[model samples]
Target: MHGLFRWSSKWWPGLIPFAILWVLAAWVSTVPLEAELAANSGTALKSTVLDKTQISVAGRDVSFAALAFSEEGRRSAVASVEAAPGVRLVNDGTRLVAEAKPFVWVAERDNVRVTLWGTAPLPASKARIVEAARAALNGTEVVDRMGLARGAPARFDAATLLLLDQVAKLKDGKIIVQDTAISLAGMARELGGREAIAAALKNLPEGFSVAANDVKAPPYVFQANKDPVAVTLTLSGYVPDNNVHAALVATAGRKFANEKIVDNLKASIGAPSGFSAAVTSALGALSRLSTGTLIVSDREVKLSGDALYEAAAGQIRAGLAKELPTGWTTKPEVSVKPAASPVDSTVCRQLFAQNLAKGRIRFETNSASINADSAGLLDRLIEIAMRCPTTAVEIVGHTDGDGDAGFNQILSEKRAQAVQDYLVKAGLPADRFSTTGYGSSQPIAGNETDEGKLQNRRIEFLVRQ
Candidate 1:
């Protein structure tokens, strides 16, 4: 009996190796089956709207877990797993995603950053919206504060994307979307930005409509700087349109006739009411200054400069406000220039010669009336005449040889008398001035060309020592 027991134990050890081999072979076969089932289950859920999707296979059984956007989606996801090839069973751990009522979303911008908030329908939808905002902002910081939810209306993603575009145009503002309706409130970053956003809303996807649009445009501004040293009047900033732009330039030409006009004005939308009238009146005040600057922002006009004299300064302060359009206001920073010291007749004569060399007194064509463009030069002459208070002056007039000699002589004499009348009216005594006309007989320049004719038709000042 002992010898039989020893032989049986040896045979049982050999059977242990065969049993281990059989178990190993079974595990290897089940591994491939589980993998195949998991792959097919995921493939089945590809068409479903689900978040945090997961699938696990133990042999032929699939454990499915996901948050679904709708009740139908939840049921379909589990059914799809069960129907996958080689999947024998499905353990569903799916729930419907949180539903939002009258789903609302917003994008807001401030000077520092742009923020996006509210509910998103799906994980993919949330990702796409954030990506779109980042792309639109062009490096501006974007803060996302969104939560996942269901119950988004049809084309919710499309509506949200379009609203984000409008948000980009705001300097500081917000845009909101509730279902298929949108509302916007903010200040536009540029002159026409508000209108651009309103225009863009017209092309919203079908079934979408605007609820309220309160976007406001930035200030409409125009500016001019008169530089006495540079001898230039530079115009800059916005104009309402091309017609207004041309009119403003023409007015400047008449007002600042001696200064070079540098036009930097741009045509844009959104000018204040009575913008042209306010600007025109303000420019007139600026023209009376020795050097000045004018800024017209909305309906407010600001003029700052040194006036030619104290009486002129007082007149500007009292008169500018009255000249502006209704509802327009003016702030004038006017001061009188310092008066010049009296000089001898020789020095005065040299000053007169220098002033006339720069610009001549102009008269209307075929008439004795002085042109408006000569006002600036005339003022300079008056100032120089004031410096030589005791000196007697001879005012002489000449004309081009384009007309009959007799008519030219009469016109020239009348023009010299007009100068004497102007000086007499400006508080200068009449006895200190004498008038004469040489007509075309004293021909210092030939009248053959326009340039020579311009030189020939001039007024000369002779300071008597």
Candidate 2:
């Protein structure tokens, strides 16, 4: 037994060195395999289709498990790991990612409501889109009808977010995203909405392209009302910008010398092709009218009111149509003011009575201020007074019994004086007219009823002998 032990001890020392050498050799061989596996695993994970990679190395052998969405991706991962340095064997446990159909999405907006539909790449992407849409469309309803899908185009989230921005600019429209191709259609809220969308689409990420764009713009409306009695012209509605607005105001000032301009224009995009030309021509027509309103709605021009004379009415109707731009339509509803005929003092008194019988002069409530409704009647009276230049006339005012006698007398006197002043301004001689007031002493009708009181208030023209 001692002899066996002695032999064993010498061999055991030798075996110890061999065992150490074997362990060292095995460890040395595994270092390069481990390094190659790590390098190849990194490369595989960086691929567009590969995910969730795990790698193990045993000597010269490498084993990897990863998820791939396509057959090409699996083949690519296997080839990449096989090419690693000092790798003799590769074990691929790669499984194909779940298959999914192509993704499609649509966002539609009508006035204040926005609706989203179709597939989203992930739960996070869907939530992000809904939140962004809500923010973009303020004071609007946003509805989502989206489902999750495994495959999405490159920069899908970014492309959809950009489309949502475009949707906000539309008055009513729909944006469709089918895989990488996008289409937009509907009415644009502004004139530049379509152009703005095109510009934005240019910045979209790669693999995204516009399939179709069909957007319509709203009509541009410009309106003006000329009041000759008030000596004012009111401009309201949309103008392209401040420069255009200022130019229009300046033009109105130059054309109508006696008119005071009131500008109530707002800035907006999308002026029609011949907006300025149409507006300028309409203003020219309006200047010929004694009182008129001009409305320019896109390519349509509408003018209505009284012309100074019959000849002027016919000339304006014929000339304005020829002056308008191509593709423009003009509608003029003009009536000529009748010229006063020459008459003697007796005939003049009879005409005055007939004219006053048609409509009485109107005064402001509780004041001597002449109301606008009396302008036409006053104009007719002035014309008649001017025709009989040598005849002296008296404008006598009367009132109903609604107020105190003294107050009514004062109001009537002031009102007669107001009429006299207006006629003088209309080019009649101030010395040829005289004014008086009778108050409620001469009522032609009963003062107990509103209609009777309205009839009782009058201004009589008495021819001076």
Candidate 3:
């Protein structure tokens, strides 16, 4: 029994050391496997398609158990794990995230009809969108062609409703939604419509994003009509802002001095490139017409009027297109007025009075300088003066009772000389016009009101036999 005990004690010590070494080796091998499983699992979770994943590792072999919304996602997760160091085998245990299709929708608007198509995540969402469309486009027809899909992106209902709101603002366009991606393309009904839609997109829910936005602004329209009998010019249209509105009004006033201006301009956004330049060129052409209408729609200009002569008509028709901005079109329908019979000096005098009675020549504010607005009236006067080249006439200037009498007299005289200079430059004989000035002493109207003051300031062409 003692001998058996001694053998057992010696063997026990050796066996203990061997057992400790085996356990240490097992632990060392398991550490790598555990570390590999943790790393691969972390990589799989970061994938957009992978919703959930379970990773198991056995001696360089990896089994990837993942829940993915798509087959592509499952394959991606597996591929990622397989590329990891020390991985040998991948057992794909991936399942689809949902059994149904993804949600998609499209809303199209044309003229007076709104059409809704594609798929909705829920029946309630489909009904809600249709109802919203009907309400937004009160008199227009709303057609729904949406189907049900099980898998929808987060906040799908809110995104669709927002898109529908934008659809109502468009004159004609389409909005599309596929999962979290949204697209809009079409023409806006009013200025700033495109900007408004883009601004609204900023409020889209998390996980939603804009794919494409191709919305466009409607064309800007400008209209002007000149009446010879009434001697008035009426302007109506939309300007980009108040600055542009003021500038356009001032331009019209300067270009048509003889004609009273009735401004009906409104301020808006979305003026096309070179809108102000285009309007200015059109007004310059309109001043040459006896009666005319100018319409500027977008980059297209249409002018129709009666010109003073055939040469003038041809010049305007041929030259307007060249004067416009690039990519601009001009359509001129100018007809020359029939030539009048030659008249004797007495008849010429009467004709001058008759035409001058309709409108007056204008001057710069508080100066003898001629206003650009007076050019059209002066042109008509020149036409009459040319008809009777030999006739002697006195160009008399008068002023309102507003300034120093001496200053007014000098201003009036300088103004008469300015008129003489303009006529001579226009090919009229300088000696035929004798100049004179009568200051505020010869006021034609009371100076108590602005209208009275304007009437009092005048120029008279008197015949000298």
- Per-model TM-score, in order, reads 0.74, 0.51, 0.64
**Would you list the C-alpha lDDT of every candidate in the order shown?**
0.86, 0.82, 0.82
Tens-place lDDT per residue, model 3, 1-465, is 999998887787788889999999888978777686668656655744454467877776777776665677667777888777667777778776544444678899998789899877655677898998888877789999876655888788888888888998899999988789898899998878989999999999889999999998887889999998987899988888888888888888777766799988888887778899888888878887888999999889999988765556776787688788998999999997665566678988997797667667789888998875666667677777877777888999999999799999998898888898888876678889999999778887899999999888988888775
Task: Give one digit per residue, the lDDT tens place, for model 1 in 348-423.
Answer: 9999998788777878898889865565566667778888999999999999999899988988888998888877
Taking all chains together, the TM-score of candidate 2 against the true structure is: 0.51
- What is the clash count for each candidate, in the order shown? 0, 0, 0
Worst window of 10 by summed lDDT in candidate 3: 44-53
Q: After superposing candidate 3 on the true structure, give the runs of residues whose Cα lies further than 4 Å from its correct spot.
A: 1-103, 228-232, 241-264, 272-281, 299-301, 310-335, 341-347, 354-358, 365-368, 383-392, 399-414, 420-457
lDDT of 2 at 456: 82
Give the per-residue lDDT digits (tens) of candidate 2, residues 355-464.
78866787888788886445545655776776777899999999999979999999889989989987786667799999999988899999999999988888999999
In terms of lDDT, model 1 sits at 0.86
Candidate 3 collision pairs: none
Model 1 RMSD, rounded to 1 decimal: 5.9
User: How much is 230 displaced in model 3, in angstroms?
Assistant: 6.7
